[model samples]
Target: MRAKLLIGRHARLPARLLLLAILLGSGPAGASSQPPRRFEDPLCHVVEWRTPPERIVSLSPSLTEILFAIGCDTTQVVGATRFCNFPPEARDVPRVGGIVDPSLEAVLLRKPDLVLVTRGNPLEFIESLVRLGIPVYGVETRGRLARILATIAEVGAVTGRETHARRLIERLQATLQDVRQRTATLAPERRPRVFFGELEGAHWTAGPGSYVHGLIEAAGGENIGSVAPSAWSPLSLETIIERDPEVYWGTFGEEGEAAARERVLSTLRNAAAWSQTSLGRRPRLFLAHADVLQRPGPRVIELLPELARYLHPELWSRDGQ
Candidate 1:
């Protein structure tokens, strides 16, 4: 499948405009081979640096996780968004407010040599930072699983840790291939129907072009929300009932496991329509660690096996034992 480019909510430019912008902003790949490095971002914008950045700030939690996974020095990572609390050590990094509404002043105060951003960040904010001579690179990691792995490579290359990045990619690729191989032979009729509840409120779910949909497909389950028009959309309770999903998965970010599970169960139990489905009767509801499942980082790989076990317990023999 072709990779989908995610430009975030703030700068939802048309594809033509986005391509033009990238063409105008960037030079040809491998424009030079000297001490100062130049690399193109997912948007095709060229980012040049005198050397690998020493003080980096990550505006997106996913990017923060990728940086840490690629083995970037923690001390050099001066700032991260408030939600970037993964890998344990990330908590020590200074917070820069929320992902979309990050404090520009706080970012500037860190005096980072490089600032990493993803979709949902305002383009104007990035431009302002550029004006102030701060190098900002946009890392797009949405849609397909391949795109997410590519983002890891991009981050590694930009940080001058290509070796580490390649190793991580290989590991991820191997795991994905193994999962695909194991689940590929299952007949369509055997594959369980799944509903991925992205948010607890209003019945938001993963749809056709979203990464979560990809995850569902990879784990040998059919995503009922794949019928939705957009990547993420709100489904009516009637629609969910009509599909009659066998499994329901939700994620919790800051909430404790017990609290998250209770909240998810409460939300489902209260919905009269949802309570009527097979998922409600047997309650195949499962809770995933929000940071692992929601963030488009290396940890997303961890979700595949968990989902497979949920959808195909007999194949696992003893719940992935």
Candidate 2:
């Protein structure tokens, strides 16, 4: 059966996402006068700040999105990578190269008092920034959902948006609970075997410890990549054929979702090897919003329910939900 088409339903941003101008238009809470307070990153680097940072640079797209989500935007977020395009305003921010090859010179030009990065960033690169006396904060981003929430709280604390962070966390946890509670009683036969993620003609599959692995399970589907070695691994084609995933779930980018979906379908249809699987015969292609589904950012809450519905429309039907 064709996977449920629930993409367009979530196209509209929730009211909370539209509070940027109202919440941050006047700028940070004017706490600059407060005495310096202690702050630290996941890497354990401490910096005493008198107030929320006025000028900040984000080295990763996930960090950039989190900053914008918690009412911190252009005025406070002075620089970001080219990939940080979201909320339609991040594009206006100056570019500081990429996570691995970020231009330190470009970052210095922004005169940022704080720079945000992820644990996935190169240690040497982070050290280089620190050696120049640039204060850096690195948050956890490459793990499970709990780590994502913790990162949001950390970003909010450092940016003085702790309240917004808590709200976002509550929503995510609620959605997670709702999905799991609703799907927990499914019969064994109801949970389909699924394969998620493919890159460069190989399976960059999600394994046991990964966020995507947990996501598929929470939505009541058995992840076929559970036996793979790590969170993300390129499984051999022979192993994929042996395991035989019935459903194929993939993520599409900002490029109009329709066109991207068709491209993926066409590629799979044209490939002979794909035609051998149950996914090819059944034609159950589950497409996910790449930014929301893959990026460990605040926007992920937008895709949570949609993903659950796609996997088990019987339990999460539109009107019923």
Candidate 3:
């Protein structure tokens, strides 16, 4: 089955050119013709604020990261999920609960004027917040990289930080373009096949239309898991062996980094076909902080080059350049 390609959160593109088009009201075909003034969320709700929101509750970790990245005052951010522990300062923010199961009581105690959520949050929870007259913005990061940028812009618009958001987007775009230029010329056959295992126990991997898949493509590697039907799916052990990817990359969370790395290495080494492929011989396995791959936020741009270097060391070598 051909995997359906989903738009990535930070896919490589002609940054300057795309930025110019977006700023000039001439973005990619089918995109909005003007810079957003009112925040329109994925749930199709229009959110407008007379003044910048001073008290905010961020239910999504990615949104929390975005709020901090775009210069939202930390003091005004009253509540964030426990997982929103990036920027170090975010750890200081009061935790509401887990991303998918935030506590309404805790969120209410924050007295937030605005709440930021993602599609993963329960619809009923969002509805309850709306029923209470709190302004809720539901951000979705499922398909395209553009949606991720749009989420940034929307948050900036509602929070009155449009300038900061625009600048951040430009910087991110520049970095994305740099990665693209370096890898764009690689021949298809030359690109290594890569498998991104999200979880070792179930053989869980990222497939077509996922942010990880986009990252793999941008880094000049073909994602072997792209045959799956959705953004994330499990691949059978037989399928993985059949693919025999040249490189194996995965994210380790909760489990301490050292243990996670050792566990993943041992699991791969024990596979029946471990002796038949590049991974079996050289074991080109890499483990990264889970959030870097899972969170669709500004830091993703920071990690893109690192992924590129891992996937194509020859291109990144000092002698090669």
Candidate 4:
């Protein structure tokens, strides 16, 4: 039942090093106090949005969604990357380009007062913008749940929506606590053995260091892919068959679970490949929205109950737990 955490893996900055230094102080019994007026980013640069920004740009879809969630609108968020298509309003923003290769010229044209980034944003891009006198702030939101919560608090301060951010964080905390309380009471052996990975086009999966891993554990399931070497990696079909997970689940881009169902069923039924194993006899599919499962943002909290319902339906069936 023990899994090793591979922190560094294939990232420019290791997940541990990418941790944000937000000022969302901790209170008694795992609660958060009021967010401070200022905080420090991963770059060790201090950030304080003394005046609410009139124009903002988001480098990632997750960041863009967070901006909108914290009371920011099209007027305030003037530009975002092409991949930011959530909340409908985001699609209306001017395209600054993709996350990895954004157009510097396009970013400059938007005349944003602030730019928000996630752990995946390039350090060089941030520095280039800073050199041009634009304030750039980032959040560490890859695999860590605590870091994601911290990001919500920090973004609220940046957008001057501290109350909104705190409320969201509190709701997220309450849900997490409820799930933890439920899972804690279950004996370890009783939890389901689960696998959460892409089975449509590829065999990619989340390892022990990923939020998916945390989610699987939180939902009372043991991640069969925990043996994978890194936070995100590919697993061979042979290995998956050997492990023979009791459940299979994943997401396909922004299309969500329903979009992924046919593809999954097709693959599992392909020439009776999956049926040859124990999984085919007792198939349990739990598809989720990629935006919630794969993307690291405030909305990932929404997956908590959805995943638990599939993993442990008995609790919900009896008392709606």
- Tens-digit lDDT string for candidate 2 (1-321): 011112112224655323432333344643454445446554666555766789999998888988888888799999998888887899999998987788889999999999898865678888888888988888878887677888888888887788988988898888889988988998868998888888237778889888888888888888889889999898887777777778888888768678877886776677777777787677677887787666788666556567778878888564575
For candidate 3, the lDDT comes to 0.78
Tell me which of candidates 2 and 3 scores higher on TM-score.
3
- Could you tell me the C-alpha RMSD of candidate 1 in Å? 7.2
Q: What is the C-alpha RMSD of each candidate to the true structure, in Å?
A: 7.2, 12.3, 9.3, 9.6
lDDT of 1 by residue, 109-197 (tens): 99998899989888888878877877788988787777789899989988778999999999998888877877999999988889987
True-structure Cα RMSD, model 4: 9.6
Q: How many clashes show up in model 2? A: 0
Instruction: List TM-score per model, in order.
Output: 0.83, 0.83, 0.83, 0.81
Can you list the residue pairs that collide in candidate 1?
8-120
Write down the TM-score for model 4: 0.81
Model 2, residue 205: distance off in Å is 0.9
Decoy 1 TM-score against native: 0.83
Evaluated at residue 197, the lDDT of candidate 2 is 84
